[model samples]
Target: MMSVRDRLEEVFERLEKRASDERVYPKVYWAAARAAADAADERRRAGVTLGPLDGALVSVKDLLDVKGEPTLAGSRIFRDRVPAGEDADVVRRLRQAGAVIIGKTNMVEFAFSGIGLNPHFGTPGNAIDPKRIPGGSSSGAGVAVAEGTSDISIGSDTGGSVRIPAAFNGVVGFKPTAHRISLKGAFPLSYSLDSLGPLGRSVADCIAADAVMAGYGALVSTPYPLSGLRVGVPRGRLFSQTEALVADAFEASLRRLSALGARVSDCDLEDLLEQMREATSRASIASVEAAAIHSDWIETRAAEIDPRVQKWIALRLATTAADYIRMMRKRDELTRAMDRRLAPFDVVALPTIPIVAPLMAPLIADEKLYNKTDTLVLRNTTPINQFDLTAISLPIPDVPLPVGLMLVARHDQDRRLFEIALSVESALPH
Candidate 1:
């Protein structure tokens, strides 16, 4: 077996030789990672394992603080902000579990856009194809794991930040129920929707990192029995406009699950989805909260901020307190409504994104295309956040490009969702 030190050395070599030229990782924790690797190696030799994450290489999104460094959250505006006094809760937990903290990955500015373009810090290209966009705001986290520079990468999923990148990079991304992992020391996007998540090469990889970060203690989740498991499919708005390839891959995965004795049926969520959309017609919950978070800088530093992000947040500055409050109330009522509606199924499955990683050139050149694509990319996964559900995106096997099979369950059903994912993951073709 290779020593942790040896693996760390190889990771360094890969990163040094990577085509993205360190764009995927803006900051590499060389000294700290070396110390952690050495410590893990000693523990391994002493037959003293800290936990499942012992010796694992982990990368965190730039949105997370790593003690003494400012949490940039992929923006240039905060470059001179006060450094953090402590590590983010998830970072502290990963260290406690003996995982080697590799570095900080790039992300969308303030984690606002799903298209993963970062004009401030060059966006990390898709791991599968360099010319394609790497989905984000968790862009670098996804690329790092996909490119094997990190075994597991941590990201925040406000509205498919983690899953979008994972889907584009062909990896597993798990978004736990909101608040399952502490967000202390992480920069805020949408206080209501932001949730810390992990992206990795497999369901088990995510499971290990999730267990550690959520403070669940060291444990392996047993796969839920697939036979007779009820799987629901929300076949309306969420399913509309999906690229043929993504839709076909999703349907094929469903058939494979059915063959494994799982029950699959369509569950209509259009009415509930319509109601949620209507409630937020004025402004999304994320934009309104983000506007408040960056209120001081939105106008004074408008030119410094990403125009796409600024436009959305600036528009929300006009959101009446009454409108925001009413939307929140409606969202709560609808969350419960969806929960009751989903009670019959173990999980609801959908494509994580409707399309593959798009070429970066066209999106960069055309503002209209960028906006349309951003909305479409986030369309499928955003609803899960609005309803406060736990979800995971599993890479479908044998696809030319990456396509994610997203599984969702009611809030607080995180472990159940993982167990189901494990079963579905094993049954899918590799």
Candidate 2:
């Protein structure tokens, strides 16, 4: 095995070798990362290891506060904000597990968009194709893992921010159940829906990182048996706009699982989806919560905000407290309904995003096109957040442009979701 120190050096060299515009990390902790790597290397020589995450190289989203640094959350407005006095909860946990913290990765402004473009900090392009958009708001975290700059990267997922990038970059991203990990010291986009997650080279990587962040210490999942496992495919509007390639890949995955003795079946939830839509018709929980978080800035420094993100936040300012309350209550009811609907399946599987990542240029040039594309990109993964379910996106093997096979489990069943994903990942043709 390579020494942790040597691995860190190689990652730093690879990052330094990249073109400036192609850089993934905006803020790097060179001294801290080096110190952590040395300590881990010393432990290895002494025949002692902290845990599974020990010596792992990790990158965090810019939204997470590292003591003495301002949390940018990928926006220019926070450039001069007061620096944090302590590391975010997740960052602290990562350090305690002997993980080497590399630095902060770029993301969409305010973590409000799924397109991953940051006008202030240049977007990190797709790992597979430089011209394509890397999925976001966890954009750089995805690229860092895919390109081997980080062994695993932490990201926030309110509406597929983590999974979208993981899918685009051909990596594994796991979003734990909401509130599974403390959000202390992290910038808030949606108090109601925001979740911290990990994107890594493989499912095991995510599993280890997740356990550390959740304060579970060293943890592992026993792969669920695929034989007789019930896999539900929610085939409805969520599957309607899937590109032919994505559709083909998803169907093939289902076939493979079935051949392995898994019971794969289509599960319809159109009526439940309709109810969720109606519940949030007044305003989305994310947007409404975001409106509150940015109420001051939206009123005074609206021009300083990303126009794309600001527009949506501004629109939600009109959501009266009554409407917000009504939405939340209804959402609570719908969450229960969704859980009941999902009870029959071991896991619900779907295409993470209905289409592969699109070229970045056109979307950036046309504002209207950008909005349309963003909506499409977020459509599939956002529902999991709304319903409070735990989900993971695994890259479909051998795809030209990466597509994700998303496996969703009932709320708070994060560990089980990982176990199921492990089985599915192993069964897939590598």
The C-alpha RMSD of each candidate to the native structure, in angstroms, is 1.0, 1.0
- Clash list (residue pairs), candidate 1: none
**How much lDDT does each candidate structure score?**
0.93, 0.92
lDDT of candidate 1 at residue 379, scale 0 to 100: 96
What lDDT score is found at residue 225 in candidate 1?
97
* Runs of candidate 1 exceeding 4 Å displacement: 18-20
What is the C-alpha lDDT profile of model 1 across 387-410, one tens digit per residue? 999999999999999999999999
Q: What's each prediction's TM-score?
A: 0.99, 0.98
For candidate 1, give the lDDT of residue 413.
94
lDDT of 2 at 403: 90
Candidate maximizing lDDT: 1
